[model samples]
Target: MKILQIINSLDTGGAEKLILETIPLFNKRNVQTDLAVLNGFDYPFLKILKKLNCCSIFSLGNKSVYNPFLIFKIRPLLKNYDIVHVHIFPSLYWVALAKMLSFSKVKLVYTEHSTSNNRRKRFIFKILDKFIYSFYSKIITISPEVDTNIKAHLKYNNDKFVLVQNGINLDTIKNEKPISKKELLPNLENDSYILTQVSSFRYPKDQKTVIKSLKKLNDNVVLVLIGDGPLRNECEVLVEELNLSKRVFFLGIRMDVINILKASDIIILSSHHEGLSLSSVEGMASEKPFIASDAPGLGDIVRNAGILFPINDDSSLAKEISKLLENSEHYQETVTKCLKRANDYSIDKTITKEINLYKSLLEK
Candidate 1:
C-alpha cells in the first residue's frame, strides 16, 4: 500500500517526531510510505529526515503553511497515494480541502495530537471545524483525552474516531549513552541535580510553572529547557526577571534529546494539557522519576507510573521534586514503575496497529 504522510514543516513537536520515527518501520514492513510537507522550510527535523533517505519526501511549497495556495499544491499529490494521513493544523485543513476540491477518493486519515487548541474556543471556528473534520475517512486520537475532547467539541458520535495512543521507541532511549553532566552543564558543579523538560515553548506547555518551581527547590537543582517556539523568548525573559538566569539553561533544539534525557537527574513535562506526550513516555523510559502536570492527557499516563503535580502549581511541583530527592528508595521505586509503564506505549505496537488500520481502510 502507498501512504502519504502530510504535515506542516517538521520543526520540533511530538507529531513531527512520530513521523520521523515511524516511516522507516513502515517501509521495512513493505509498505511504501512517503512524506509531503506544506511548508518545506529547512528545520532541524526536516534536515534529519532528509539524511535518513528512508522514503520519498515532497515539498509542496516554501510559502506560509496556512496559505490557501497549499490546498491547490496538495490536491494534485493526493492522486498518487492510496492513503493520505495528515498531522497538525493548517495541514489538516489544507489536506481535507484538497481532497474535497479534487474529488479524490483516496482515504484521508488525520491524527489529532492535542486535547485543546485555539480553534475550539470560538463559535465561528466550531462551525469551521465541523465542516473540516467531515472530510476525513478516519480520525486518530493520540490519547483518550484527545478522543473525548474532539468528540465533544464536534458534538458528533460515530465510529470515525479511533484511539491510537502516541508512542516512542523505548529501547532507543534506554540504551542511549548519556552526555556527561560536565558537558551538559559546563558551569554547574559536578554534584548538581538537573531538572530537564523537553518540550517546545508553546501555549499548551507550562514552562513558566517549571521555571517558577525551580526557585522553591534547593540551589543545587537547575532547570534545562529544550525545544524552541514563539514562547521561548518569553520564557527566557521570565528566567531573567525571576533572577534565575544563572540556574536555568535554554538549550533550544537539540537532535540528541535521548542522550540528554538519560543524563538528567529528573525529567519533567509541565503542560496545561497533553494528548499523550511522547516526552512523557521518553522521560519514563529514561528511568528517571518522570514528573508532569496533573492535566487531562498527561495525568492518565503519569498517575500510577510517575509523579503528577497540580496543573500550573509550582509550589506543589517543588514539593514533589523534594520528596523524590529526599528518599532514595522512593525515587528508585518510581523510576522502576515509570520504566515499566513506558513499555505499554511501544512504537512497535503503534506501528502494527497503524498498519492494520491502513489495511482495514483499504478493505472497506
Candidate 2:
C-alpha cells in the first residue's frame, strides 16, 4: 500500500525521529511511502527521508486545522497514496482536514506520541481528541498510558487503540565508542560526573525542574541540558539565580544523543508528563541510569531502570540524587536493571510490529 506520513516539520524530536525510522521499515516491506512535511524540509532527519525515496510535500497545514488552502494542496496528492498517517498533533489537524477534502478513499491513521495535558500547546491548539478521533481509520499511541488516558477524552467503546511503544536501535548506539566528555565540552575531565538530559525545553518536558534539582545536588555533578526550545533562556536564568553557572551546561540540540548518553554517568528527566520519552529509552539503551519524574508514560519505562521522584517535588528529587550518589550498591543495581530492560525496546521488535500493524490495517 502506498502511504503518506504527515508531519508539521521534519525537525528533531521524538516524533520526528520515530517517523524517520519508520520510512525505511515501510520501504523494506516494499510499501511505497512518501512524506508530507507541513513546513521546511531542511532538518537532518528530513534530508535522510529524501534519500529514502520519500517524496516531500510542503503543506500549508499549521497549528490550526483552518488552513483553507491545505486541503486544496493535499487533495491532489491523495489520488495515489492509499494511506495518510499523521505523526503528532498539529499535523493530525491537517491530516484530518485533508481526509475530509480527499476525493479518493485514503485510510487516515493518527499516532499520539504525547499526552494532551500539554498546557502551552493546548492553550493555542486545543487538541480535538474527542470522539472525532474515531473518524480516523485507526488510532495508535506510543505507550499503554496513552491508550488508558484516552478514556478521559472519549466515551466507552471508542475502539481499542494500538499501543506501539517507542523503539530503540541497539545496533545504532551499542558498538560506537562514546565521545569523551573532555572532547565534546573541552572542559571537564575525570573529575566531572556528567548528568545529562535530552529534551526540548518545553512546559511538559520540565527542564526547569532539572535545573532546580541540580541546585540541591549534594555533589558537584555537571548538569548538561541538551536540545533547544522556548524554555532555554528560562532554564539558563534559573541556573543563574541558583548560582549554578559553573555546574550547568546548556548544550542545545545535539544530534548524537547516544554518544552523549554513553559518555554521561547519569541522565535526568523531570518532565511533568510524557508519552514514552525517546531520550530515556536511548539512555537505557546506552546503559546509563536516569532520575526521571514519576509521571505517566515515563514512570512506567523508568520503573526499575532509574529512580523516580514526585513530579513537582524538588526535595524528593534531591533525596533521590543523594541516594544514588551515596549508595553504590543501589546505583549499580539500577544500572544493571536499566541495561537489561533496554533490550525490550529493540528496533527490530518495533519495526516488525509496525509492519504487521500496517499490513493488518491495509487488509481491512
Candidate 3:
C-alpha cells in the first residue's frame, strides 16, 4: 500500500520525529511511504529521511498560510496514494479542502498529536473542525488525553477515534557513551549533578519552572536544556537574573540529543501540558530515572516508571531530584522501572498497530 504522510513543516518536534522513525517501519513491511510538507526547511531529520529508499519527500513550496494555491498544488499528488495521513494542524485545513476539491478516493487519516488545541473552543473553528473531521476515515490519538480532548470539542462518533500511543526507537538512544562535562561544557564542575530537559522552549513547556527550580537546588546541580524556540530569549534572561549562568546550560538544537541524554544523571520535564512526551520516553529508554510534571499525558507515561511532581512546583521538583541524587537504591529502582515502561511504547509495537489499522481500513 502507498501512504502519504503530510505535515506543515519537517522541523523538529515530537510529531515530526515520531513520523520520521515510523517511515522505516512501513518500508520494512514493503509499504511505500512518502512525506509532504507545506513549507520547506533544512533540518537534521531531512538528512535521515533521504537515506531511506522506501520513502519519497515532497514539498508544496514555501507557501504562506493565505496561499490559496496550496490546495491546487497538493490535489494532484493526493491521487497517487492509497492513504493520506496528516500530522500537525493547518495541514488539516489544507488536506480537508484538497480532498473536497479533488474528490479524491484515497483514505484520509489524521493523528491528533496533542491533548489540547485552543482553536477547538472557538465556535467558527468548531464548525470547521467538525466538517474537516467528517472527511477523515479514522482519527488516531497519540494518547487517551488527546482522544478525550477531541471528543470534548468535535462532534465525531466514538468509533471514529482510535487510541494509538506514540512510541520511540529505543535503539537510537540505547547503548551510547555519555559525553563528559569536560567534553561538552568545560565550565561545569567535576561533581555537578546533571539534570536535563529536552524540549523546545514554548508554551505548555514550562522551562521557566525548571529554571526556577535550579536556584532552589544545591549548587552542585546543573540544568541542561537541549532544545530551542521563541521562549529561549526569555528563558536565557531568567537564567541570568537568577544568577545561574554557570548552573544552567542552554545547548541549542543539537542533533546528538541521545548522547546528551546519556550524559545526564536524571531527566526532568516541567511542562504545563503534554500528550505522551517523546522526551520523557526517550529518557526512560536511555536507562535514566525520568522526572516529569504530573499532568495528563506526562503522568500517564511516568506513573509506575519514574517520579512526578506537581506542575510548576519548583520545590517539589528540586526535592525529587535531591532525593534521587542522595539515594542510589531508589535511583536504580526508578531507572529499572523506567526501562520497563519504555519497553511498552517500543517502535515495533506502534508499527504493528499502525499497519494493522491501515490494512483494516483498506480492506473495507
How many pairs of residues collide in each model?
0, 1, 0
lDDT of 3 by residue, 1-364 (tens): 9999999876778998998899978888888888988886667777778766558889788757446678888899899999999988888878889999999899999999888867877889888899988989999988888889888888578999888888988876776778876888887788888989999898889999889988778899998998888999999999999999988999988888888888889998989888778888998988789999998789988998899999989999988988999999999999999999998888888888888889999999
Judged by lDDT against the true structure, how good is candidate 2? 0.75
Q: Looking at model 3, report the run of 10 residues with the lowest lDDT sum.
A: 61-70
Best by TM-score: 1
Error of 2 at 244 (Å): 1.1
Worst 10 residues of 1 by lDDT: 166-175
lDDT values for all models = 0.92, 0.75, 0.87
Quote the lDDT for 69 in model 2: 64
Best by lDDT: 1
lDDT for 104 (candidate 3): 89
| Best first by TM-score, ranked | 1, 3, 2
Candidate 1 structure quality by residue, lDDT tens digits, 1-364: 9999999988889999999999988999999999999888989888988898999999988878879988988988999999999999999899988899899999999999999999999999999999999998899998888998999998776698989987898778877999988898889897689999999888898899999998899899999999988999999999999999999999999999989998898999999888889999999999789999999889999989999999989999999999999999999999999999999999999999899999999999
Candidate 2 residue-wise lDDT at 205: 79
Worst 10 residues of 2 by lDDT: 118-127
For model 3, the stretches where C-alpha displacement exceeds 4 angstroms are 63-68
